[model samples]
Target: MRRRLLLSYVSLVVFVLLALELPLGLSFANAERRRLTSDAQHDAFAIAVRTDLELTPGSIRGSTALRAMLSKFAARTHDEITILDSGGHVVAATAGGPALGADLSANPAVQVALRGDDATREIEASGDDILNVAVPLIAGRDVGGIVLVGVDLSGLSHRITSNWLRLLVLGGIVLAVVLLVSLLLAQSFTRPLHELQRAAKRLGDGDLGARVKVPEDPAELRELAESFNATAEHLATLLRSQQSFIADASHQLRTPLTALQFRLENLEDDAPEHRDDVGGARREVVRLSQLVDGLLKLARAEQAAPPRTDVDLRAVAEDRCAAWWPLAADHQVTLETDVPIVAVRS
Candidate 1:
């Protein structure tokens, strides 16, 4: 019972944690992803505005300035930047990026940017997760070039993983505390029941004084214990009253049975022709005395509440058969005994 109660408590706690934490973790992950994507798109558009002013038609003077700006921005933000001409060929890029003059038109973000629209996507490049944002560079009502920004997502993934781990650890702590509290609660509930069980066993074993202690808290259990105690007290009082009555009745009967036997014995000497009658009357008086003795013994045994002991059935049978042999011989009957050597609690 205690185990079942504890299991139920732990199960409920687990269900509540799952219901609350699962969606919370997912929401945090999605929000983080969106925030990072928005920052990347903003950076891509900022670079596009600057690049639009740098690369004018038939202007070679701005090439050095553009490369210097791209390198500085890439170094500070740790993002890869690539500039593509209107024909989809890379003109300038950050160090370790796509080579200059390399065609990247087949790239989805590049293709979308070439169509004069902004594009954002998440992709894997060189075994690393990247969030790519592309925007068109406006050059006097025509597309001058494309500005592409690739943001590394390893840090974001790490942040999300760290948060999830923290949540898991918190859940574990909560579950541990719940398990301990549940264990204590279960014990508190079952301890009273265990005491009641022991008391009932004692009462069943004839210890009529056995009783349970009522608890102060938990009104229902207290009431149950009180009821049990009341029942036991009433039963004990009834049995004691019965024993007293049986004792008094047996005492009252013994005097009459003894007097009857004495009168019958005296009649035998006074009348020889009535000897048979006197003998029969004397036997009946003896039987009555034995019955009274039996009743007294029963009352005393009830008060004593003696412990049971093992008795050998074969020994008992042999003793009884021997004691009854003379009576059987007088009746012209033979006494035979067949008993197995078995032990039983008396």
Candidate 2:
């Protein structure tokens, strides 16, 4: 019972944590993705403006200066940068990026940026997720080039994983605490029942004094315990009264039976012709005395409440037949015994 109760409590807590934390974790991941994407887009627009200025019609510098700026921006932000001309050819790229003069028109973000518009997308590259932001460079009322920024999303994934781990650890701790508390509560709740069981067993074993102690809390259990104690007390009192009555009745009956047997024995010598009658009366007196003795023994045995033993029915029947043989003969009744041996617990 305790295990079932504790399991129920823990299961409920786990379900609630999953219901609340699963959505929270997913929301955090999505929000992080959006924020990172926005930052990447802002960087792309800023680089486009700078590239347009550097590539102005009378500029003294060439692609060397543009490459240096792109390399510096890429190094500081840890992002890959690519500059593409309006004809869909790469003009410059950071180290470890696509080769310069490479055609990238087939790329979705590049295709959109070449048409003088901003584009953003998440794509998988080299077994990692990459967020790409592309913006068009304005060159005097015409599109000059495209600025493409790629941000790795491994860090965002790690952050979200770390957050989920923290939530799992917290949930585990809460469940552990709940388990401990529920165990204690379950034990407390069932303790009274255990006591009642033991007391009932003792009472069944003939311990009239056996009783349960009433608990102070949980009104229903307290009342049950009190009622058990009251019932045991009443039963003990009743049995004791019964025993007292049996003892008194046995004493009262034995005195008169003994006097009657003495008178019947004394009358035996006074008349020879009435000898048979006197003997019969004496036998009845003896039977009555034996009955009174048997009753007293039964009362004493009930008080002791001894453990049972095997009794042979055949032996009991033969003894009963022998005891009533004379009475049966006087009544002209033939009592025949054909008893079978059977063992029974008493």
Candidate 3:
């Protein structure tokens, strides 16, 4: 029961943590991704506006200045910058790997920008994500080219991962605390029940003194403990009253029975002609006396039993037979005793 309760508590805590943290973490990561995308798009649009200003026909000076600006922006942002001409050729680039005249028109983002639509996407580059933002460069009614910006997503991913790990750590700590509290609560609830069980067992085994101590918390359990104690006390009182009555009745009967036996003996001595009647009456008195003795023994045994000891049944039987031998002779009967030496409870 304790284990089940603890498991239930931990399960609830885990569910709550998942419900609260999963969406929060997902939203935080998505927000970070959106922020990166927005920044990339803003940089792309700014570069396109600058390039548009220098897009005049037969302007080599404008192209050189644009190249210099692209280099500086790439160095500062740690992102790739490419300016493509209307013929889908790269006009200026910060990195030499793509070359200045490389045809990048096959790229989806570039193709979308060439069609005069702003495009943004995540692309895999060497096992890491890169955010690509593209904007069309237009001067009046003529399409100059496109500006492509590619930003590394490593820093964003790292920040999201770090924040999620912190959340997981916090969740773990809360779970630990919940586990501890659940165990304590389980113990508090079950301990009293265990005590009550033990007390009931003792009472069933005839220990009338057995009782449960009521706990302070959980009103129901305390009430149960109190009820058990009350029942045990009442039962003990009833048994004590019964034993006292039996003991008192037996003692009271013994005196009158003794006096009656003495009177019968005197009557037998005085009236020889009625000896058989007197004998019969005296035997009845003896039987009554034995009955009273038995009642006394029973009452004492019920009140307080002596510690157990082994008794020889053969000796007990022989003693009983010897005691009844005079009665057997008066009745003109032969009494034979056959006994075995066996151990019996006394």
In candidate 3, which residue pairs clash?
Answer: none
- How displaced is residue 266 in candidate 1, in Å? 6.8
**lDDT minimum window of 10 residues, candidate 3:** 55-64
Q: What does candidate 3 score on TM?
A: 0.74
What's the distance in Å from true for residue 264, model 2?
5.7
TM, every model: 0.80, 0.86, 0.74
Cα lDDT of candidate 2 equals 0.84
**Best candidate per TM-score, number?**
2
- Clash-forming residue pairs, model 1: none
Summarize candidate 3's per-residue lDDT along 198-240 as a digit string, tens digits: 9998888778899988899899999999999999999999988
What are the Cα lDDT values of the candidates? 0.86, 0.84, 0.85
lDDT of 2 at 183: 91
For residues 34-53, what per-residue lDDT tens digits would candidate 2 score against the true structure? Answer: 89988898888888878877
Model 3 misplacement above 4 A: 58-62, 249-346
Best by lDDT: 1
